[model samples]
Target: MSLRVLALLVLLSIQNLFAQQLSPEASIRVLTIGPGYNLNDAFGHSAFHIQDHSQNIDMVFNYGVYDFDTPNFYTKFAQGKLHYLIGVNYFDDFMLMYKRQNRTVQSQELDLDTGQKQALFDYLLENYKPENRRYLYDFFYNNCATKIRDVLQTAVGEPIVFHEPEAFQPQTFRTLIQDNLKTNSWGSMGIDLALGSVIDQTATAEEHMFLPEYIHTFFSSATLGNSNKKLVKQDKTLYTKQAINSNKSSFFTSPIFVLGVIGLFIVIITYFDFIKGKRSRWLDFTISVLTGVIGLLLLLLWFATDHTATAQNYNLLWAFPLNIILGIQLLKKQPKPWVIKFLKFLFIMLALMAFHWSVGIQVFAPVLIPLLLALVIRYMYLVYYLKNEKL
Candidate 1:
């Protein structure tokens, strides 16, 4: 059903229940459905208990990630087979879904209600403190427990105390230390945050997520994922040496390989220059050779091993070394004052502008032309200076 239609049915049900000589002793509750918050489905796999006492009803909070909604419906919820459903959804839509069923609140802001609707809205304004939103300090508050509390109080025809979600603690400090060492690599930030600090290696976030993925593809067969399914392994692609050489590595890889190659080249180039004998152009050659070698190493490392994360650092490793050679060629006996001033202005301006995400270059490819020009200008200055001075 469309969200609008499903909402109307809930409101109609509430009115019918109230008109049919509603018993205050009769229970009423809302079960939210979505990622990590699945309290409504009888057959749903959830963590929260929803026991509908003969005297009252229990609401379940279900969270899910859109279309992947798990709709298990046979389990008795009295004991707590609900909860732990978290699905991705927009914030406003989430709030609107529940306001429709606060049977006790005569006001219906989502639809339309007159006197009681306005009163309930006023009450909501007083109670729903936007400042207390958790993601600001924490977000689980609005999305989980507090939401369920609103439903229960509405159903029972009385005020109910909203339980707080568990607090983040530092107990995992020791375990995090060990884990950091064990899994050391790039992109660990997302893994650490997603896992939380429970510290139990068995349920560690990285292991639960990355491991399942690693196991499914790395070990050859899908037996581990298909048969021993504790968590469903999403489509994580497996990488191989052949694929890395071919172009499959564009997705993500380590920077270590590129770094190693750069280090080796630097050593080789340095040794070669020492043996070849020095000229008046020695400084220019040294800087160009070392910087170029190092920069190329960085580019390769980023491309071959490192995951292409932010574009600030990229696979354009050749740019630096190439600029060095060009700069040496441009060195001069005396630089024009105007040339010096313009180069300085360009470099400083570019550096200052680097952080602006809205800058044209960041937003579009055409913006890069200016950066290329600036690089050329800098190269000319270096070359001009190398003969007698330096930029």
Candidate 2:
């Protein structure tokens, strides 16, 4: 065990001995930390803050902590089997960490009575135990933000009736995520590619708590089941993010710009190949390997992984895994007769992909437009060349 774990155990024992009952001045609040620049921190964070002057306890219970040293960490993360822990930090230390990150921090005091406050605090303490701290983390349902809402409901032993905030607007899960990411960013494109149509469905108001800001907004207007009293008794902004201009990347480095350039080059190469009545075997091989590898990875994400959001992905239609075989055939002096039929099938798949995009069956990355168009043209040219080739 690490020193941190030992320290937490010692702290827990001391708290149990002397702070069984919190003083009337003890307060329990929810802290909402604003989003940071990185993809991992883009969704912001939520934690529970418990403070008591009489007991000399001031701690933040955060559910977002994960160990990078865990065995097979990256593999487990990719398979959606990674565990997150309930981390206990000194309240001042927690604030200082976020302050250094230049993220905004807001707190909302709960309107719970002394008994309720103690119950919630006790529950957090019990949950903080080593065995109880680790949990299977889910992005939309059981992440740090959603844990705050669920834990509050569990501790209060009552339903939380969350009302829509005044500025609330209906949005899908994907859109909620996109709100925190730049449209042309690699992070946004990756999310659009990996997650499927499930996130495209409109999220219910209660479901919006998956995001930290939404947790604050909904909790501000929420009430306990037994009473109409507001769940949040007070609110305060502990830190405001500074207005320093971020170093934005140039458009030249953007996914759309880079992909567009590659796509244009492919189209130009295909045009030359068509005029010369010749096929660029190397180009076909490269494109096929790239799309085939991507397709296989997507297929694995859908079936081999525990990720719920990667299911029913339609990107496979454009990135056919069988293209790898076609690429091999294209290298032969006399390709198989079925290669022509396979190219036609790939063309049809592209058309179906376009249909799916048009009807909102799935939302693919917008940056793929140029690449997809180039692919269609290349496939069509290949079909023509194969059909006209002599035995």
As for candidate 2, its clashing pairs are none
Top-lDDT structure, candidate number: 2
Give me the displacement of residue 135 in model 1, in angstroms: 3.7
Q: Lowest summed lDDT over 10 consecutive residues: which window, candidate 2?
A: 10-19
| All models, RMSD in angstroms | 19.2, 2.2
lDDT of 1 by residue, 196-276 (tens): 212322333212212112122222221221233222122221111121232323323433333334444444544454455
lDDT of candidate model 2 versus the reference: 0.89
The clash count for each model shown is 53, 0
Residue 81 deviation, candidate 2, in Å? 0.8
- Model 1 CA RMSD to the hidden true structure, in angstroms: 19.2
Q: List model 2 lDDT by residue over 1-391, tens digit each.
A: 5767866765765466334789899999999999998999999999999898898778889897987878999999999999999888778878988999999999999999888898898889888776788999899999999999999999987788998888778998889999999989999999998888888889999999999999999999999886898999999999999998889999999999999999999999999998999999889889987898888888899999999999988889988777788778887767889988888898899899888889888878899999999999999998888778853
Error of 1 at 261 (Å): 2.4
Error of model 2, residue 311, in angstroms: 0.4
